[model samples]
Target: MAAVEIAPTVNPVTKAKKPSFQIEWASSSSEVKEAQRLRYKVFAEEMGANLSQNAEGLDIDEFDAYCDHLLIRDQDTLKVVGTYRVLPPHKAQEIGRLYSDAEFDLSRLDHLRPKLVELGRSCVHQDYRSGAVIMALWSGLAQYMQKNGYEIMLGCASIPMADGGHFAASLYNSLNSDQMAPTEFHAFPRLPLPLDKLNGGLEVDAPPLIKGYLKLGAKICSSPAWDPDFNTADLLTMLRLSDINPRYAKHFLGL
Candidate 1:
């Protein structure tokens, strides 16, 4: 069978010549649609993931209506290089739940939900996956959290399971001891990854996004969940504002 040739992402971002990228909330529905299109390109076209709710090359979902869409756009090309959908507490209440609730049981986190924000559908254009672009995204997130007085953030960090889940299993086991959250905050996955059946000895570095969260003192609050549609193992990660690594917190929050 012939392999799918993924489209090359345009206009790569670099540290030396970083493009003028502006991060802001989506001001219009069109902007939100653009972010969704970028997501489809990466999560669907590039990775070959099956998106059941995807429509017209956009990763559409009910949560989108209730969430704030943050976009990082390249001023040179006027293209959206990165995006994150943030569900604030009130909006989560309006929607009656968060997107993460579908993949994992978050009942243990009810107490934190009042001051918590749920981050979902986070992605950066493949070409713009540089330190500058990602940092810009995080800087926006930090500002949003502080501006809104959010105490905690939660999201699912994904690891590709195309290797038949071995790497995901190994990565989970490797980080469990040091990065795992307390039992009181533990979540249960709806479709848990079968770790026992997979090899957990392979030494593989976590993906950059996951690693960044860990560097910021994010905790893995549950075992891996098998997301068949996305073909990845999802780890529930939580980060409290007070728990951020002091060294990097200033950089992200501009403190």
Candidate 2:
């Protein structure tokens, strides 16, 4: 297969000349469709998001049209290895819904100032799950956030599991609930799980992504909520840009 060719585009914010690995802001209709295609491959086909035909193997919704899409293309293969969607707080509030709202309540956050940004649909092709790909995606996001003056980053971090088993014990262990709970915590009672059938115990450490967020001083809000689409309960996490650990700031943003 011929490598997918991506033309280099200047970063609107920095204006610094850098040869990104086909990093571009998706603007055209075809680019959006391609993003949907990649989403289908990862979310529906690979992750089993239980989406209907309307989802078309694509994990998209009404918000996609209004949000900005970040795509990372493999230079040699020209394939989209990683992708994420960023929704500005203004747009999110106008839309009155977030990707996690289906799983958790978000109305309580209406009072927070400085606005917010919701990060979602974060997925990388299975074959290209590496530090470099993730780092590139974050680098692009950091630049975009810095340019826009975003104050906080919020999103749900999924804990992977085959069945409906939840894996947020470590998060509960790490951050606990009282110190920093989500303003809109889940009020519903915990769903039952067959603890005996699960592999070993479920109380393992946090996943890399969750740990990464915590290391960045992100606080876990409330308990886990069941996400049928992904077949895993997710814990909502929030990271204030000012609170991010200095170590990651240097490593990820080159500060």
Candidate 3:
């Protein structure tokens, strides 16, 4: 596939021009390595997770060889700002692992036969945590998903808090996904959330990103799971193509 090119645009209200960022599927081995370097920088160096090196300051595993790497680059400086890895269900099945499977039991969904895409290792550079960087990444993913015939997107939405389990329960209490939650999925057997705690009393002030997913019709799948690398508990979430609201499709996908 050809690399995606994005052009810079000016903000109507501020009358200021913002640098454009392009998102594309990594086209070469070197590009993939660069993407991995970015991931290592974010997941390991910045976030304090362990990493194995391949002599180029990149953290990579067998899973990366088979997955598609989506990279976002600033138009002017050509610096990579954000990235996300997409793994198809067939590849995941062959490897006997789904990114979220480490936390959630995915066996029950076997009968559904949906073409699933696992999105993970999502990150944005600290300096470019603006809306444009994120929008570019999603736009690129949408284009790739449209091309690949993917029907569902699933992943672990990791929270970066030391006491993430407690926060996750509180999150679920307010944005309940009980109807679509996986019956057999959970993080740990012990430390089960008290019934009273699970009661719908989530704080009115939850994280914006989590709330955005709920608004996009994503369903939380069971309890959150502990993510050692991220030092947090993460909730599994899924977005079926059909479940995505039309307004979002029009706004994001330009459909």
TM-score of 1: 0.90
User: Candidate 3: which pairs clash?
Assistant: none
Clashing pairs in 2: 4-77, 4-78, 40-57, 182-221
Query: For model 3, where is the 10-residue window of minimal lDDT?
Result: 186-195
Return the TM-score for candidate 3, rounded to 2 decimals: 0.83
lDDT of 1 by residue, 62-138 (tens): 88999889888887788988999999999999989988898999899988999999998999999989877777788
Candidate 1 error regions (>4 Å): 1-19, 53-55
User: 1-255 in candidate 3: lDDT tens per residue?
Assistant: 777766567567776564577777888899888789898888788877767755777878778987999999987788888998988878887887776656666666664434888888888887888777777787787787788888888887776654535566666566644435556533332223343544334464556555666677777775656566567557677777777778789866667
lDDT of 2 by residue, 1-255 (tens): 112223355667966553436666787877777777888888788877786666345666798987888888887676777888888877877787676677666556645524678888888888878666776777677777887988877787777766446344433544555346555633321442233444434457776667667777787765666666677667767777777789888855567
Between candidates 1 and 2, the one scoring higher on lDDT is: 1
Which residue window of length 10 is worst by lDDT in model 1? 1-10
User: TM-score for each prediction?
Assistant: 0.90, 0.78, 0.83
Candidate 3 lDDT score at position 55: 71
